[model samples]
Target chain A: MPTDPKNPSGASTINGTDAVDSRRKPGAAEKSWEEKTLVPTLAKSPERASKFTTVSSYPIRRLYTPADLSGWDEDRDLGLPGEPPYTRGIHPTMYRTRLWTMRQFAGFGTAEDTNQRFRYLLAQGQTGLSVAFDLPTLMGYDSDHALSEGEVGKCGVAISSLADMEVLFDKIPIADVSTSMTINSPAAVIWAMYLAVAEKQGADWKKIAGTLQNDILKEYIAQKEYIYPPEPSMRLVIDTIEFGAKHTPKFNVISISGYHIREAGSTAIQELAFTLRDGIEYVDWALRRGMNIDEFAPRLSFFFNAHSDFFEEIAKYRAARRIWHKTMTERYGAKNARSWALRFHTQTAGCSLTAQQPYNNVVRTALQALAAVLGGTQSLHTNSLDEAWALPTEFAATLALRTQQIIAHESGVTNTVDPLGGSYFVEALTNEVEAGAWDYIRKIDALGGMVAAIERGYPQREIADAAYQYQMEVDRKEKIVVGVNDYFTKENPLDILQIDESVAHRQAERLAKLRAERSSDEVARRLDGLRIASQGKENLMPYIYDAVKAYATLGEICDAMKVAFGIYDEVAIT
Target chain B: MSEKRIRVLIAKPGLDGHDRGAKIIARALRDAGMEVIYTGLRQTPEMIASAAAQEDVDVIGLSILSGAHNTLGPRLMELLREKGMGDVCVVIGGIIPEADIPALKKVGIAEIFLPGTPTQAIVDFIRSRISAAPSKA
Candidate 1:
């Protein structure tokens, strides 16, 4: 007989076979409650829908109790903060000792213009610097390149050479502040620019603390700002990891990011699984490159997105730490405790912001920021209200900074570590996220690894399906996005930031002047040296460092490498 | 009556990779019985214009989120006009600021779709704007 999903095992068979049979069957009390209370209540007032689910489409149980986490062991599953399997948090005193770094990702217009914004945010109590490069800079092109037209200093500041990087941090001391650069594909080259600038500032590499978002896998997976194929790209990432482990003890080489993955319309669980799996791929490649896991793994940091789901987002961060801890110890044989801890930066979900009723975005951002804080994020970036319309205007960016400030100073959430640790619902959800992510890992492992899985379009297809499913839900009114799907409004237009048209002209002129003044022969020699070094087994960071120091523009160096390692064209699966 | 599908070229004209809006509109237009060509990301005005000309698209839809609309918007229009494709309907989408609307419209863009504009509204606009015999060549 075919299995009837509703009543697969007969009522008679549910009574006395084994523990499994008894567990599947509702208890006598639950059955009585369902028959009497639930049925009558439903008949009188029908439930809103046949089923309810989280934003990620995970089913939401009506109520959770200790029974939901029946087999969960406190020691094994929910160890104390700063311990192995740190589901509670990575640090013993997560926020009591020091709060998360208030980092606002701000970069637009010229280097001088963005430098001013940096000073303003720093004066307004922003703790860290996160650089957002313009399109040309992000894709390894000079400001004057044909592809860089109309895009110079539009999205983020355009930094084409060490000179621009130096101007970007004019008065800001690299020694005192931790900076995060959101650039990949050409991350190795861009990071070299930053290092050269720091060297000019007389800052020691070991003492300079910062993070480089050198996660090219995510670029191929979501961001699509890639210049080279995955193989050579992975080589560049490993080179940085090896270089950082040896030299820059304080700097985090790769911020394994799921922020863009979630922004590209992945479920929360997909974001978690794919991000950790990417981290695993990086670790495996590094080990293959002859680096010890403990040497590089401890410095590896993560970046995640804090979406609108409050409890779910909190559980994701907690579960990520736990999963990373277990994977490092059991799977990779990492002996150092710090190597097991997953330190991460969280940014409020830019995807969740609605262009309608733009003011409502402030509330949404506050809630998401609170979720990041409650989840024990090491650093945070709150999106501004006007972000969905344009890059945040100065006023809007200030308010976004204030969101993080209010959470840190005003809110009493920082008084305890893992304040929601004992809640049955939170604990249960944490385990569920871990279990779900492990299932994805197993599938990826079966396909050989993440690279093999990516080649076959596994995660990409999963995210696209999830995105389509969500849009359908919103269209069918199954899900409610305030001010978007429901609670409609005619948004009174807000003041938006407009990049000046002269930025491109000014940037091109600067590049032209630099090209005239710099030693062309030195640039050519450095680039050729970089090209030859890129083809060999030796690390390319030293060559990139030399090239940047010689004032070779980003495009020049990247084109040189392109000669050795050809450009990447994405396999279109959509 | 046999109707040729509305061939629309959708191009991302800047470095911003937030394609949720682009992908959504592409699918919506495809469902609405239009042939949409999606140029993935980081396309220059030159590349976009070249693609539009080669594809012989009746409509060119540009998506820009980087606030470079003032610079790129007019550049694309001029490039398209230079390519002798000025008759093609041009629609602009993504985080376009209100202050820049007059300038973009002044440059001959036929429509501007803000973030909240419905996908159906876009489909209807494209269908209504194109002439009866949209140049199939």
Candidate 2:
């Protein structure tokens, strides 16, 4: 017990011997309780397991109390919502004012086919759109390319040129809907096609809003969809940041992502550390390109994965905001408060889904989505139940969307802002996660930032090790994943959505028709200009836009740049 | 007499970059006292067949997650036979649906491992299968 002058009731005053001095510290109280009460109970009946840990295998304590947060300063560590450090929340009135945008990542088959799915999702109350390009498009290949076999539209929509992009958006008004494209390697070329579509729709460039997953650093570290080497890829990213700052004022040029990194098997702390470090690396590059921090930093958004472990996920997001705030204002000298605030879109962890007992994934996804909402995400994409089997079917996708809707409309958790802000466990865990991430940042800084560290295979090795350890833990039954390792049951396989082989044939035919109709001379001249520009220090977005306007294929534009910047081959490590 | 250790060549065919499973399998195989060579991401069928031949591996572990297994799987088998390495133990692991597993086996994929499979199970499967067959070496 401790006496507090602020307590008018004198509740803390146990005796009249200098009230405050007569009380024991919380640590002493906890120690006494554990010895007298906990030891006797534990001796009588043993606990269920010898040890407990989070999904990441981090140790979990028996309980969290004020003793855990000895160094926490309320006003300094966590201020009011919509204020500095942003640990509580970004806005003062978080979801009470407006709910997060429900953006389901949907794509599979030709542009026409995926367009139907997009319209269906929008009709079902999806507030935003996220395009999932097929493997060929993600790898910068046309549907007719030799490497595109059996993969034309299996994973996502096949967009070969601006013609395909136009059909993808079809009747959708570009100015009204905010779109997010999950493209990485050929992000510049694909973004040009998107801008070309918006231009044709008479949408003003400055008014258009969306996010381009233009994070190439994470590609090398985790996703492995990289085309050009790190040096040239970074140049392309900085070019987009510069161009977007000057032109598309509302669009986020780069969504520095930890989603793929986590999906590739990283701990939550690793995801937080590497993603923010990737953001720092981009800011450094943009500064070298002669751009002010406030100019482009405001448009730099982030994407994270809302995995299981509810408290850990929530703490990760809180720590992310606080770390970003400190880095922007103190480290980079950003003057704009908008630049200091870290806004992110979260998707339920796809790696957490199970192929066996597929219906159980619905429950997992709902819980993960709830975690994203509680973590103060700006936008959320709930993964479908059948994703582990294949791309989501219409029924499954709708159920995933409904999960988010239930949380927003039915769950009472959204009525208040940062409801878990004052919890002892959450606040302490936020500080601990932040400290773990700072250690990684310091290590990466010693390795000369993320790019150099990636080239050295530091982060990749760390993630691989973490992944292997987690798998081993699951194998040894140390971690119990329901319906996976334990609680075993045999069930019929779910009916998954399949892409017909004719999709490849149809996409090839469309590419041929476009080639035959478009101007060959204009395509060649524009490609020649792009090739020349790639060898120089000029901004390549305009050159790519010109090539896209002339109906040059995605593969052709990427090939033009490949002529100047050779392909990068990473050394495989196990 | 010293026993010959199994040699595994883990290759990622096609353009998909989901290599978490592949890398984990490679490490597991190595930990089980086998020599492993991983052909990194974006490797085509021809590249994989050539790497398997060059590395002189006894088993070719193909990881395809882009649903291109129906095409890439058969194509790699043909390439291996053309390279006179038809006796190689060809195994595929990824998000292979149950309905497609039979067709994959028909195309000469010895085994298909889906998600949530234990690494020990994979290790045991490889050992039992490889020892049952004649050693190509």
Candidate 3:
């Protein structure tokens, strides 16, 4: 018997041919395994094995062995954690020392409402806070702006001025708990606003720890929450990196994100590859500004998507750590050990949550959350069950928070470090994912890094293809989504949460009052100063901090600069 | 000679930045042989209505993950009517509570595709509606 060239497994590899490869006559005993099994296998015949392709459509073997990672070296490839080439895990003890940060993405409705959720989460043993800003805040508009209209507290918390920010963090000790702000384009301004509120609370900047998702490269590629074009955006990111290095020692200027890319329908491999490329672009920008790679790289954290494909997602994270470490030490000549380690925050896959059978999402989220712990994440945010339908209800959100808590305290998975490290299947998949990502990185380098590739729509096209292939598999009943395809239930009413539209109306009124009370002269002067600074080569943090101190509205601040910076209109794909 | 391919504009209107549904739909429409234009994140009703007229698209699908769908949907419809472009079939997609669907219908929405709906269903629905239109001749 000859092994099928395409079929790594004994199962015949189906490549759009037929149900099974019929070229060779099957022995009389071959069909016995399929017919006699207590449970029916997904694909009984070898020829129907294409369904096992990973999210990127890379064919997966049913089992993996040492032979799959034949070329891997222990010292050169999988070095000790907290060392260069950190494939095994980031820190030496990983979760054994301290479990990954259970940072739930909490924010919705008005500032006051979101504040309660934040306080509740922190009170329930949540170590860190991750802010989710409304569309108005994310898109650089204050709550009262006409353009803000019906969206103030629609998607996330509405922050208009320092008053809102002050109220949002009212009783919470910003100094003690680390925070992560998921803001990109207008990152500098929002960060400065946070800084202002912290100062008013008498919190020392040096003692406060948090992350601003200031990585603008990913915004251009996946999350279209960008305000200015690439050049100015990159400038702002570099400005943050520079400012953080000089002032806020504990602050991570940016969290280079693959989470958004994955959420934007990118494959796991594409997310890893494009995200690393985006990270490299940031380092390049900082280096060009004469900043040392080691100075800002340690705190250069990452955010990832923990999808339902348990093994694949785990492999993706492990590969991400290895690739970043290798690229930093070997390629960029990074001297610091921290510079080589790829610290990351993971969130359970938002796209994987099905609106049908809303409760099933809790199980999916728990499974993905477990994978993140085994995958060696430094921090994580678990998706609420009802989010696929709406902003999670208080009950559902508490369940989501408890999901992470149970995994951390009871699961025993966190008792050990990188529990899946030496597994044959996981290691093999890690190697496979790393190689796939490396191949893309090389191709992107050929196209002159992430920006040029983005301009050519390379990453977008690849993500589109992967997304399309995944949908096709789902349609063909190959990759069964329990609630969607396999389990057929008729008209089960899902308990969906509803945010009242009045939240936005009230937020808008608050913004109007805040604007009227602020000194008009101070706002005008700060805004004008920011505009003039935008024309020069000055670091934007100081300018943004000044504007935020003057209580300049988010929209007014963005508009003053959008005039000089000009709006970014993406060129249609060629 | 190249036939004029159906150019569609898929917009996320009125501060609803949750675009997983819209992005999937846009890609599906594009794959179904239509040139899709996606205006990413947090668009106002006026901006969307103006864009619909400016792009001169065959269809305008408003994707709202935010609960302001009731208010935002009506605002866009009113603006579209004011612009004399009410003929553009604006399909509402995302988590619209069953009770709110009628209110949307009252505001002149032709169709509403909820979260659980398949991508092919949308593609097929758009194709049939576009082909059956008498103005196409």
Candidate 4:
């Protein structure tokens, strides 16, 4: 076997093809052991199935030894935490310094109603705020718009104007707690409203810390909430990154998200590969926009999904960090260490939850949360048990928050950084995930980055195929999802929280009152200015900020921009 | 009688963006010898009712995850009635709180399918429901 003097694993090179080589081969002794000991045991009990594979379809071997990683270079591949490449972990101290932020996503009903929920969660020891906008707001429709009739304040909190934003953060200080808004399409406009609200709160823009899910690429590829076409949409994203880098240095302008992609039924490896590729695409665009790598890269954060696959999820995170480090340092020549680090927030998979035996979701979320913790996430949001049914009830959401607290305090996992870092299986799996992701990245690069690849429906088709394949497996009983295909039980559905029906009417009234009171002339002037700027090369942030300050509704501003930028018609792939 | 494929209009009303369930149902229906017209996401009740009429679909399936089902579901049923397309059997799915199910059914939502439901179950339900209806073709 090849040996390296420096590698802790006593292996050799960890770069290019050498790293892909298996370290040890089965000798006559192993063969005899398999035949004598393994074959007899298998004859009695037999393997549970003909084959075993991970959720991502990575075939599981009977055993992994030095043979599996014969040329693995520990130092080169798995470095110390907080070091270059960040394969082990991002921070040297990791959870020892502080646990990942327990940010529970909460938003429903009117702004005041959601504000109360936010306060309640904060009081219950939730660290940060994650705002889930209602359908009208998410789609950039006014509360009173014809299309938004039944959707106002339904799925999430409805914020149609700066007035609603002000109420949503009514007593909450903008400067103290970092907020993450799950908004896209009209992300620039929503972000401008947030800035206006912060200004109203008299908070320094530079001191505001938060993340905007301004990931338009993933929207097109997975989420299907896209408003503009690819080129102009990317331009809007770069504008925010440049603006955030210059002004709000503490804020992450674009949260390149794999959460929605995974929720849309992408395999773990696809989520990793496609998300990282999206991040790379953004960086390329920003670089081409005359921005330095280090200036904006540090502020760019990622959002990932922590699915049910324990090792697969953890390995995905580790692989993501390593791939990002290599790309930033070697590919982009990023000098800043922070630029090489891939800081990400993870949410336990909502799609993994089952409506039957809904309480099982709590257990599933705990395992997913543990995987995320071990994977060294910067932030986590454990999904509630009732999420599969509807918006989580208060009791369920509190229990979900308690899940994270238990992991942080009781689980004892936070005691060390990268506690499972040196495991042979984890290391081997990490390499496999990285190699798989690299293959996808190279394929995407050959197609001239994500935009071109998305136009050709590359990632979309891949996700759809994986989703269909998984469904087929589930249907055929090849996959045993508890309470789904196996251990089937017909139980009464659990009590789910229903959104108050009056929310839409109340929000519409609020919108009407605001519209009646606001200065019409000023709103018109700023909107005209915004429309003019949208037709030019000017950053849309300032113009959007101006229009938002004039108390223009989201739909009005988005409509004005639509006139200039036009809307995108999605090419249905599936 | 003319043999016609069961035309199902699967529209996601409101802006939940949770299309996995919708797409699964669409594909399943298509596989089960049905012409499934999926109108993508953020489709309004009006748009759905109009599409159901224009497409001459035999069934209208509304997949809504955004708790706006109580509002959107009834309104969509009403719109279909206004269009005199009451023959269009409406089915609702996705994340509907059980408490609201009675109200939804009262407003003419023929069926409700929650999560963890198999695609075959949905397909079977559509087939059984449509086969019972008198042929218009």
Candidate 5:
């Protein structure tokens, strides 16, 4: 048995001596059964497959028994709900008290167009709002910029400035909804615009709640919408964390995400390890900024990908909760119970959705979402069937939302908390997953942290290698993707949502009008103030708010910061 | 005279950073024993065309997941023609709607590979197509 460095006490050893004495000796009984019954059956009819594995390529054993968790202490490892280690669930009455928030990510074309979709989703019983900005908006470019050509509103909604943001939230009660914006490097500027909109709506800053997908470390590692270098980008994230802690106390300043990491083709272990390490990196930065751990740590939420592989995905979540609790309490010495809890939102894996037989994706999403629910996600997003082609159409998005509804209302899985908490397979798999993650965390720590590791292209290279290996597996028929590798059929293409070319023209015209009408002098002065603040040691939130309020475009504000903190060019490795 | 090895340039052109397909294709082509150069992310049509010319590659693979392929694909072909490098074999991939495929091909895209296409198929297509053309060298 390999020893775990994190469990230096050898407490996790599977010696079978620590097991309760009342039960039969599981190890010996298993061997006896294999020799007498199983061997004969196998001789008569051999096992079907050569090897069984999870989607991550981790081997799956035939059966798990008490021997698999020999030295395990149930109370120590799987704590009570709402208690330390949060191995079961965060709240005592998990989904019985409140069902997981069904927040389908929706954004495409202009802000007005997306606003209609947002209203439609809310009317259809969506509990929260999650915005997906288009490429131009995500990359901190205006709709009229040269680089923004043909990309104004293709992938998501185009929000160029405060004006667009206001329209996006028009007629919607911003103070009531918990909005989550998926923006990275330009997250600060976009968040400032959002706060400005809330302020214009006469909403109290402290009362408003939302989350910013402001984890820039993952941008360098996985999602590549990054605008600045690691150091400056981290400064912006920390600034938001510090600002949110003091002012917007109800808001999640950053959703330190493993969603993109998994979508970028990482194993479940890598996703959990890197995401938790990223949380550690942020806490380290915030502490370096002279903040207490309990102050901002409570609001630091997580986002994970709910891929296929029912047991592995569940084990991953359980391990994520345990590992985070241990890290916060043991490593950071966090005192508050809320600070130790790992609250996460999960999105069904988009990469797993198949283009051929797109309708099969509905079943795939239902299973993935069910796993997320059973694993105790606080919120969830189910990918639409047509997402492999384009941004989901209205009918598809509504159907995706209904998938969550069916799981919550019709599915009986939510009646109990941590329903699979103590299964022999689940418990053993959770421990194994946690051990694997700890090994990776130690490796990343040896590399000086995630930023240093990313700078050396460590995680990048690992993910690329895993991605290549998975493709090779699929190609060789070693692993089968239902619609792609097996069950092949000619596909009749479904009608996909298309962002009209006129979206670019309309956005450009709106931008031109905004530029012509707004005070360019005020914009320039606020941008200059922001540029100066970017150079200094001041938290950039206030300066960004000032620029955003002055009607400065996203590109203008990001440009001002870019002048101080130059652009980052990644060392692309394949 | 010794036969020249196939040279390919795999470029990610657009603001979006969905490079999983691009990098996989690049590695696949390289494993197929062809020389491959990846231009990383956020390259414009002009930059991709210029890189293809500068590298003197025979095949160019453009990966655009941002839905900007309709614009970037044609402009890239236009630039290649302007630079008298129109003989280059260009293929596009990633999240392309079926309705856009014929138009892209009309604009000189040799082929379009949507998601779920095996790397071997991409490799085979590039190999067969490039070998069929006369040596530019």
Candidate 6:
């Protein structure tokens, strides 16, 4: 996300008047409709009143008549859904015909433990599988590795091999349920493990479908998980894109993610802009590899963070769709409408969770999830109330799922298409977020795209500046965080979930047994063949599947390549 | 003694390579006129302690979001004690539960700043906690 020296925090640009500090006006805050006439509205007359505001603080006007979005040509800017420049949505009847995939992210401890969780979620009626690999796997290391000792499955599932991934999805119908892995640096290997699991189940390559958070650019900017230099990383992404395009067309090769970037403290616009920029960078890499834009582009998906801001998140999504549409159709010459559509999965803001007043996170998450739904997310995940404490407990996870259900069934907001689209505030904020994001997109273009900007530490610096400034505002009491800086109560009343550390030891014991039971010789031959394939131009998925089927560990496959490509220790940006 | 730069080591020990907190703190400390040495992501406790020893930093700022802080923070403090660097201040910030603070403090953690603790407080804590460079008396 580009940082304007003027509006550095993105959320600070709008004057404080947008949200009347509820602390000062109890009557105004409590009285919803009748007593709210004191608050000025630009909708009454745009020229007479101040503009609406995005979460990032970008000023949005009260009304977006054709005048607000002045130069935007309807045919050029706002095209029909599933058509080139898919500003509306990828599917015309987005939630009307089909409910978005209920993909809850779940995984913790060893592969078997996470596997049990997958089956549980599936049994609980989850439609899609989403993987949350541990820090060790995300950082490209095996569980037993000293660097990964206690970290094995602390944050997510510890996947060391096809053996583990197999345990993870045991009886969970990989062929029937589409899966999405939130792995980046080791995404290719992890994806290969999933394919191996599917193959062992007698599913063909074309039949297995899932998504990989293969967007490595964010690794440099926020996530800090990269195995190779940008060049080789781009090579790995192109390999997957090309492979998926040719074989499993249903598979989403890459999920351009803004979740981490936002979690790393980027403002809403930064998340939107940086995420879109990373997507363009991937397309450029694939295009350079001689793959047609439409072939791989149509399968590319996105992941976003639905933050605490209600209207801001909705506007951010609308802006993302518009920006991606224009960038793909106008910039990349994406002939296919599918290529232009910005189909994205959203998760409620985990960063917004507070360890203080932990139950407050549920209300925060519900609001964020509703924003995601109204924003037209293709899929959504609601963070559990107790996630700020530890991996969600069964009770907490159920509540999180129920939160989504309540929004879907109880909430009638979905009765209309683009429910918030015509709002004077939403449309204006949508245009503002889009403009703010383009400011960065244009700068990245000037600097020769995301790869070059990353090399120059542009995105990294921009995110830092925004985070720093936002912190400054929060500290100065300019921004009111309910329990943090303002209205904070010393007597904290929140239930925090506690997971026993013994879970890891038990998981490791099961894993060691799984490894001992598998044939070592088969693992060796398959892994050796994978290493050989890596030396050449073969699409690495088949070889990866073979290695995974042989019960080869993710570490073995990543280690072979780390020897060739070397691991990426992020260059300290500060 | 003149206000010599406060040398701080910002580390991500034990693989929850979440450096956002560490990075923000580093930038804040640096802006506050301190010399910050950031050990990049995925550093082990031994590696972090070794770097702190070699660098002779006045403060070790451990950022652990992996929930391994319970195990990792204690281990680092014990290693610091073993290394005869017990006087060196150790401050940790992350997703640490409030209940664990007393136990961590008992192990001689100089301070534990949880998430959302303003960066200025950290800057101030470091400035005040890092024993003034032996007055040239």
User: What TM-score would every model get versus the actual structure?
Assistant: 0.93, 0.96, 0.90, 0.94, 0.96, 0.89
The best candidate in terms of lDDT: 2
**Mind giving the per-residue lDDT tens digits that candidate 1 earns over A1-574?**
1233443332333222233233443556766766777666655654444445689988666545555677889989988988878888888898999989999999998899999999999999899999999988988999998777778887899999999999999999999999999999889988998998888889999999999999988887887888888889999999999999999999999999999999888999999999999999999999999999999998999999999999999999999998998899999999999899999999999988988889999999999999999898999999999988888999999999998888888988999898999897898789888889999989999999988888888888888778877876776667888887678767578888878768888888998999999999999999989999888888999999999999999999999999878987665444
How good is model 2 by TM-score?
Answer: 0.96
Tens digit of lDDT per residue, candidate 6, span A1-574? 2234443333332233344222222233333431354233322422332333444555443223333444556676556666655555667776778777888998887676777888888788788888888887887787777777667777888888766777787887777899989988778888877776777788877877778889999988987778788877787888888878887888988999999899888989899999999988888888888888888888989999999888889888888988888888789988876787788999998888877667778899999999998888999999997766677887788788888888887898767677665554576567677888999888899999898999889998888777777777777766667788877777653455455567667656765886789888888788778777777766777777677777777778887776557666657776
Off by over 4 Å in 4: A1-24, A27-29, B1-4
Predicted candidate 2 versus true structure: per-residue lDDT over B7-120, tens digit per residue: 899999998988999999999999999999998888889999999989888898988788999999999999998989888999998988788998889878899988999999
Q: Report the CAPRI category for model 5.
A: high
Task: Give the winner by TM-score: 3 or 4.
Answer: 4
DockQ, computed on Cα atoms, for candidate 2:
0.80
lDDT, candidate 5, A203-293, per-residue tens: 8989998899999999899988899999999999999999999999999989999999888889999899999999999999999999999
List model 3 lDDT by residue over B19-44, tens digit each. 55677788788877898988766677
Off by over 4 Å in 2: A1-25
DockQ of each: 0.50, 0.80, 0.42, 0.58, 0.81, 0.62
* Residue pairs that clash (backbone atoms under 3 angstroms), model 4: A23-A70, A24-A67
Error of 5 at B37 (Å): 0.4
Any runs in candidate 5 off by more than 4 Å, and if so which?
A1-26
What is the lDDT, from 0 to 100, of the residue A555 in candidate 5?
Answer: 94
Model 6: CA > 4 A from native: A1-54, A60-67, A72-76, A79-84, A492-519, B131-137
Model 3: interface root-mean-square deviation in Å: 2.9
lDDT for each candidate structure = 0.86, 0.91, 0.80, 0.87, 0.90, 0.78
Scoring only the A-chain of each prediction against the true A-chain gives TM-scores of 0.95, 0.95, 0.91, 0.95, 0.95, 0.87
Per-residue lDDT over B56-90 for candidate 6, one digit per residue giving the tens place of the 0 to 100 score: 88899998778787888889988998999888889
CAPRI verdict (incorrect, acceptable, medium, high) for model 3: acceptable
Interface RMSD of each: 2.1, 0.8, 2.9, 1.6, 0.7, 1.6
Error of 5 at B1 (Å): 9.7
Tell me the spans in candidate 1 whose CA falls farther than 4 Å from its real position: A1-37, B130-137
Pairs of residues clashing in candidate 2: none
